[model samples]
Target: MGCGTSRPRLDDSDCNPATGSTRKSAAPITNITQSYQRARCSNTNPQRSRAIGRGGDAKPPSYEREDPRRPGQAVLNILKGGLALKREGTVNAFESCKHKRILVLIDDNHKMDRITKRAICSLASFILLIGHGYQCDMEFRWPGYNNNDSPKLGTAGSEMAKALQKLMDTKTWEDACEMIDANDKLQEVGLKTWVENQLKWKPSNDQFQFAEQYRHHLPGEAIRVANLKGNDTDEDLHRKLRVEARSIMAKHIAGWAANDIDRTHLMKLDTEARKKSERDQKLSSNLGFEYRKAMENYEREMHLGADGTPTLVILLVASPITKTEKDSIIDCQRNIMASLGTKVANGSRDAYAMQTVVFTKSMASANLKHFQDIDDAFKGHHDINDLTKVEETKFCKNGPSPELLAKIFNSNLSSIDKSELGERELYSQEILTDGKGDIQWPSHEDVMRTFRPDDGDSDSEG
Candidate 1:
């Protein structure tokens, strides 16, 4: 009997393969008091043997402590107030505390404003809303606005956030417009919309990247969308424009032409009409131009910039045609009308800080927030485009100037860019009424109050 004995094997199953002999078992009896004893190779566990690092095959893993946060996630957490980048404190409504943040979430990102963009995307900029101008801008926390979606990781989240914030700065409007114009990616999505025509873009917090990636190339065709957003915020000048256009066309075409000339044929006649006998053709050629400029001039005179001068932020033709023409002369010219409309809308924005939009159809702008749909929202105050002397005085209060109505019937509209208009081009959608948009829309007061509930409480004391 031995102190460390092994039971005898029934067969030579413990033979060493290398030596072709039975393996020797124990030298185990040597140190009886030792708690730690080295085991013989034969007694070593197979799993433990494999775990030991062998010559030139492998080595044990070595690890060092590190911060667990990803750069993007960390920056995002700070923005959402899940983590603290700045000192933690809570004070008044002026303070950029967690409680002060206003998280604005909209499932629909189709139409957005500049402030909405900043509030949603950029954490750094969202804090800057407080104390921007009139008072402290409450912090607006946009849902899912964390910087996890940047194209690049690491500093990309912070960098992208900063870039988004900077894009929306009041000082950056001109640069942003220019950038959108130059960058084909931006122009594809930006220029086609009502907002872009006014030199505005969606500078939202979270989805600017998504917009850039998926802003598929919309049909490059020209659209027939017109809006009259001008200094007359209280007036539905677009309806007036429609009435004016109808009046002008009706007046010119009453005895001038017997037949309804196809717009395409009329254009050909206008081009070839060097002969005096082609008087009707000549008049028709100038009809679109006349309509455009008269409306432009009307828009120009009615609206004023922040400095009291004419605002020329945008100059779109404000035509009321619903869509591209199969044959209608009415639907033929829409895109160029914006040249005047933009000025009106921009002036309103500059002078009054009002949000304005012009859509061909009431349905086109459905579900949009923070904007006044001039075409869909306001009704015409006058039946005819050429306002009566009394109506004119009532509309402007200071009275209409001779210079403003100078070119009601004539040539020389070279001041505007010609490229905006095209006979062959057409817009992607049609939502407005056929012919002049004479359908009765609601009053301006109701439309304005619909966008902001707090503004309509004039009857109630705070």
Candidate 2:
């Protein structure tokens, strides 16, 4: 046999190369074993023939060798496929772009998922190593699954809801308390177990990472102590202080009460003070007084003359006075001027010089008699120097002619003479005059002679 030759199978009875024979032997297995040992010692391909004899498929040894570059190639293929999909446009350009964007997002998510898995695995490995009494920090980059089968996050609320519903239906306080306590304890245990399982690399079937959303925050003191070397940056410190301040502000706001008796009393006092101030302002700005002052100022500024002004701008009521009561009327005028002076300081020129005027029918009949009395009464009075003026006119009854009465009563002479002068009224009868200055008052005979009586009346009477 050659040194590098293959061993013969048990079915092939040709044991020696010098003689080839096919025969059934009692120790055929012995011959095959001897030949296999010899082939092994001679460095022949005995393993291939052995595999064939055992009904195993023969394969090249190169197939067992792992390619170190295969992972990189796979990553490249995936990237190329992604790019190809992106470049390939569809009839609906919007949907294509949207799909591409989603694909890119999915790719980024996959990368993040890989990184997260590696991080979790590293942490879990660290925990395991710590359990086995390892002291050094170890970083791992391999991915792992967390297959833990604990109750999912947020389920505690549902459980509480069920218990609360039961308590509402039954109205048992003790049972409700027990249920709450039990739920609290259950939540605490669940939290602890979940943390333990995460640290121990247990796999989870959840679609989302619960720890990602519901994180256990470390205490501020613990964080500060952990950062003994003052590694915290300025931004981090500011953020921490801001968060603390916001928390404090929130606590104060949550406990705030608007109905505090002291605060309410203070507010009432403030409101009363404001109202009093408004009232004082209103009293100070008296519209009537201000209006009078404004009118006086305007008249003084404009320098208006009596001819350009009205005889009476306003009418005021006054009692009729006799000529003997002239001093009393003058005193009243002085008082009115004083009141006008108090309301308006600059009373040099006003709509009314004396601010009041009194007129009586008897004074009008006496012409200048009552007028002189009024002037004399106010002449020496220091308060009514230029501030007062009095005037009188003829009375309607004692006028120079009946025209005065007509003007006073705003009526025709006929109507006035008939009402006041009686039967001796003017224009009582129709007068006829010719151009020769002869006038005649028609008597009843003349009027009857001018008009004939109706014939029908004359015939009916006789």
Candidate 3:
């Protein structure tokens, strides 16, 4: 039959009578191939299909453009959905959301859930919005939010309060200024007002008195004395001035102690007295003993010319002896006299034959050569008796008695003994040896080496 003539009987075989050979039917084959080509073309040209629709030359539906300034519609939708879920008490929207950050809106009427509050706080950063009727307030809290600790938040005011406190405590404008300047925040408070107030402030009476005392001394003098010159900066000059002012005040206090006999004045010089009094219970008693001893020494020197006074006073003018060396010499002489069966009286003469008086360099009014000649006369004698024959014709114009010479020589011997025993003790054997024989004088070092502490002689104590 012809391919289009009559319908052929349905058969599973691939043979066609029209083709006259074993082949698939052409009509069915053509229909299958056309359907596959259409499908393949549609798959490969998807953009062309999207650009054109059933209407032909049609465009895709466009979305409304988002305003750059306003929140996105998606964000608004999510917020609305979250609020609806929160009202329904389904899950806490802030906790259930996969978003790393979210805005939390709080109103006067809305009660915030604890978990929502904690989640908001735990976020790395978030915006907090508060609604007040028609108005909304927004605040941002980030990783480095410092609550009330920032200098912008009354830190300068707090520092100013502390500076005022220090001002009240120190009562000095300079000290208060220094404290205020040390704080960066307080320094922003300005110094003009502080300076004006300081100028108006009246000093206490004691402060006025101290200022008056140092009124003649210039700040330049302090700078010079402190050895702060070209090398020192302006700040160093100001610091040195303050230190020098303090030192001058201390010196004034010390002068009061030295010149005046008042106990109060002396106590002023003893800055550590209060601390010592706190630590030592017997501090007051010890001070009393020292004062009494000083008074006794003063009285003995004042009454040197009184009767029964065996002490002979010698004035040393421009003597080579220093005060310390002189004192050591005198102590050594007293010890030697004590060993010779003659005891030096503590106060008035009791049984001692003679007491030698040694004057300081300040007391000497005589010629320098006269004192030098006297020093030569008493130089080498070991025995006190031998010193009595020293000629005093050159020492004094009218030659004083040999007994006076003995007193001077004995006093001088004490110094010689101390020198021999103290620093020159090692060479004493060579230096003190006369042509006749060794004087056998004991040095202070030898005495100290042989000395032993007395184990409580309780019977003698009784």
Candidate 4:
């Protein structure tokens, strides 16, 4: 209930949902990674956490965090305490729950009884570990079209890992920087400026080659997030961090993280409700009727206690998640089209609205540093195969290439050739013009025609 700054002790029984308990002796994450996690939770109560976050047509995240320290431990403690106390927060769409839209993942419409919630903090951890010089003892899995067809964290991880691996091969930060400066990869990538200017990464006094600020993620924490097969993500809690971490996140990842996390939480609530009623014999004719009813009950109760409970929908995705895929997910949610519901009949909406309130990491900390690099340095994050490369991969996925869609948009319906339009271009046209062969901007006459009052049926007539 109290989001205090006290963290879990090194020998404490940290609640790890993966193994059910953890024994890893950990430290305050040094920099970048650990700081990012703390930053995720700290933004939970703030009004402007996401004011400056991932953009360029990106959507806001769904879930939020409350704890200023260890997210996993904070949630476990709350679960240990109870869900009866207040945990209220907000996002762009959580209010839609009241309008009767229960957000669902509905992956490929495979009649999945299980819902998958995307933990952004979990994702941040996943993203943070890519090149932090630590190898996860487990395989971090992100399921795709199928198990074998899942997406990967892109070459950014291996790239960062390779760089850090070579860096760690050195005895100290100064030596590491020298090796990088003298290296071919540095020269080939032309990262000498980034290395010498952006990433000095001086070593900690403890003799580790890592930066004193490098918040080295715990190995157990890494593994817990790797395989998201269970409720391993600290659903009940979240993170926050220092300036450097906050600056990068604020300028970069926050928006997507919030949007995705909220969507994931709703997905989980639906799945859990179905699991609660999978054995019901009185299921209606609707395929997920029982699921709907179970969720209806959940909504009835959660909303009734809405005044007393804390609803958090915060997440930070930096893995195999992509702009193309993330957009599709939103279209499914906002009803632009049935991308995920292509096979399944989307004949009905959920019987309830989302009631969980998560304070989002939407706006960045208002008191951010006015550093030159903070704004343009991290924009390339949107392009990572998954967001893993810590040192930055391609120096912001900005260039002339991204403007092709806008170029396409400039063409009128009768102007461009249809057969040759690429898939993304097709999709862009689909949403904007709605596949109706024209992009319409309705005039006053159209609005009047749409909602014209029936003859003598107007209240004025009465």
For candidate 1, the clash count comes to 24
Higher TM-score: candidate 2 or 3? Answer: 3
CA shift of 343, model 3, Å: 92
Q: List model 1 lDDT by residue over 357-416, tens digit each.
A: 122222233322212222222222211121101111111111112121111100012111
Q: Give the candidates in order of lDDT, highest first.
A: 3, 2, 4, 1
> How many pairs of residues collide in model 2?
8
What lDDT would each prediction earn against the true structure? 0.25, 0.26, 0.27, 0.25
Which residue segments of model 3 deviate by more than 4 Å? 1-76, 83-135, 142-462
Tens digits of per-residue lDDT for model 2 on 40-63? 323324554455345335432331
Pairwise TM-score winner, candidates 1 and 3: 3
Among these predicted structures, which one has the highest TM-score?
Answer: 4
Worst 10 residues of 3 by lDDT: 125-134
Best by the lDDT measure: 3
Q: Between candidates 1 and 4, name the one with more favorable TM-score.
A: 4
What is residue 205's positional error in candidate 4, in angstroms?
26
- List TM-scores for all candidates, in order: 0.14, 0.14, 0.15, 0.17
lDDT score for candidate 4 against the true structure: 0.25
